[model samples]
Target: MNPVLGQVPVYNAYGSVPALPLGWVENYTPTGQPYWFNTITNQSSWVYPMMTSKKIPGTNWLFVLTHDGYEFYYDRDSKTSVWEQPEELKEAMQELKKLEEEEKLKKEEEEKQKALEEEEEAKKALEEEEENKKRVLEEEKEQARQEVKRIKLDQAVDNAEDVEATEMTEEDIMWQLQQMAEEEVGMDREEEEEVQEEAQKEEEIKQVEKKPELSEQECIEKFYQLLKENNISPFAVYSVELPKLMLDPRFSLVPHNKQKNLFNKYCHELGEQIKKEKSQNTKKPENEFKELLESKVTTKMYWDDFRRKFKNDPRFKALSVTREKEALFKEHIRNNLNKKNPIEDYKNLLRHVKEIQKGIRWRDAKKLLEKYDVYHAIEDKDKREDLFRDYLDEL
Candidate 1:
């Protein structure tokens, strides 16, 4: 009935066929043409098989060829086929792309959150470090205060011990007399009278042992001595130094108001002494600086000009501080060059200018004076013109 059936294997029925490739079976249509059947996909086609369909790796798609020799992709779960790729595979890829974007966004958010947390932690750690330093400084100050208190307490205890020892000696003598009187209760009255005379002489000796009170001047001198012994600076402020001074045993000897007055008086005298000493110490160098300025600098020269001219000199280098050297230069200018009279110095400068003859107009004289450094020394144009007029009047 069919010529192709003679070329293919003959079977009594489709179930009676021998084993074949996976998901594939050789069969014939009712018209007796050769075709293929997929036992797994349950689909039939009429084309000579080259190979069975295979699943694409990691996907629900299969690489398929039709029995008519057309190639495409197939999705068995959706039972859909396409010439290039199945719609289900495209949808799955879209879902995967969305998931990847979401994952990337989630990762970035995690990194940002982690950075914020680290920044906050760093700020907290810095605050803690500063707090610890402050705590340590406070502890050190407290320890110093306590040490000063301990020294004053030790001195007070020594003075108290001396007074207590004298009182204890007197009490022992009285106790011995009492014991003797009780034991000699039947003895004569002359013995008791002799003991009373001895006790009266002891009372006179105790009165002589008492120390005299110090005068106000003596108390003030003692406070100064204490300050010197402690090496306190005369420039130290009274309020700041009061706490340390109060720890001294001599501090309480004077009345509070008197102590304050005495402290002010002592500091004033001591500060003057220190100032005089410093002035004496620095006088030589100051004189040297003044001499350098007189020799090398002039009123015509500015500070920068002087620096450029004498920067290499030993005297200039010796005055190391910029402000101090500038101060000395100004003082030298005031004393020597300007003679504490800048207007007169300018007038003299104008008189010296050969071009500035008497009765010359201020405008013409200013042009001539401008050629000299002294003209530029007076910064105000109006002042220079006024000084020029004054010099003309003198002429």
Candidate 2:
């Protein structure tokens, strides 16, 4: 027994134990020894010369046997050793190792594929979620737009109803016509009385100037001089004096019809003269009445007061000449009454249009001017500018 194997008893057949094996070699030596130990027992043993010893053909270890059988191999380079197992066990272990490696590789590939699939699933889910959100937002926007459109449409309907509500009734038209007829009848009576009184006064004044009454030509020359002196319309004079002229003694020899025709001819000539002289001062009563209407002067009382105040003015008389004319004038004014834009807005728009006009944008100016009835009468482009300046000065 080798001293390095430690002191231990060796067992033989029949369980007889001894301090050492029966055929154990003592002080053993060999020509070439393998640096090896029994790996299973972690011990080195002595080899007996009588036991068979064979050198493994292609390895460094010499296969040796001792009286007690045990086998192991040594690595020449690593100088490490392992016990030899049974042939069946060795084959089974080799197969198990190969199978483990193949299973490991397959498991790794499966894990990688799973990860790729999970990533794709997550991306698809996120895309679907985003698409749903975008669709929902679009739906919300469309709903909001529809709601706004509905509100605007409702507002338009309400405005149309309001406009319709403000329209004049048939009763109002009849009332206006009745008032106009009454005012015309009163004006006619007053005019007839004034004409009679004026004729009486003229008879007394001309009684002393009867130095053989003036000829028709001289009478016409005097009439022209009177028109030049008095800046009055021919219609104003014609309404009162045409009949008087037809009955005057200066035209007694002339047939009554001839005198009437001559007076009409002179009246037309005087009208032309009046037109030339008063054209600059003439204003459209339609426009003036529109202003008064805007001022809330809609009653017949107001109109009658206006007529009494400006009775001497030919323009006022012209406007009130007929009930039809008066009704049309009021209708024109009512049609232009914009309940939406108050007087203040009208003034402000007038100023804004003026600024546009200063830049020579006449077409744009005309469009704005059309909103107000008074502006329609401002037909002349230069006159519109003057009106703008005058209104600004007033402001």
Which RMSD values do the candidates have, in order? Answer: 38.8, 63.4
- Candidate with top lDDT is 1
The TM-score that candidate 2 achieves is 0.22
The RMSD (Cα, Å) of candidate 1 is 38.8
Which tens-of-lDDT digit does each residue in 1-395 have in candidate 2? 23686533232223323223334433434765533344333456653224344444334543434447755444455544445533434554566557768989999677556645654566587679968976796687567656755775677568556765577789966876686577567756765786688669768877874645668777656555544454434445333444333333443444433444555666687778768779758777766655544564432222345546655754445465556445655454445444333344445557755444444445666676664544543345666666556565676
lDDT of 1 by residue, 37-90 (tens): 887667787754453465665687766655556556656666665565545577
lDDT of 1: 0.68
Q: In angstroms, how far off is 66's CA in candidate 1?
A: 92
C-alpha-based local distance difference test score of model 2: 0.53
TM for every model, in the order presented, reads 0.28, 0.22
Question: lDDT (CA) for every model shown?
Answer: 0.68, 0.53
Candidate 1 structure, TM-score to reference: 0.28
The TM-score leader among the candidates is: 1
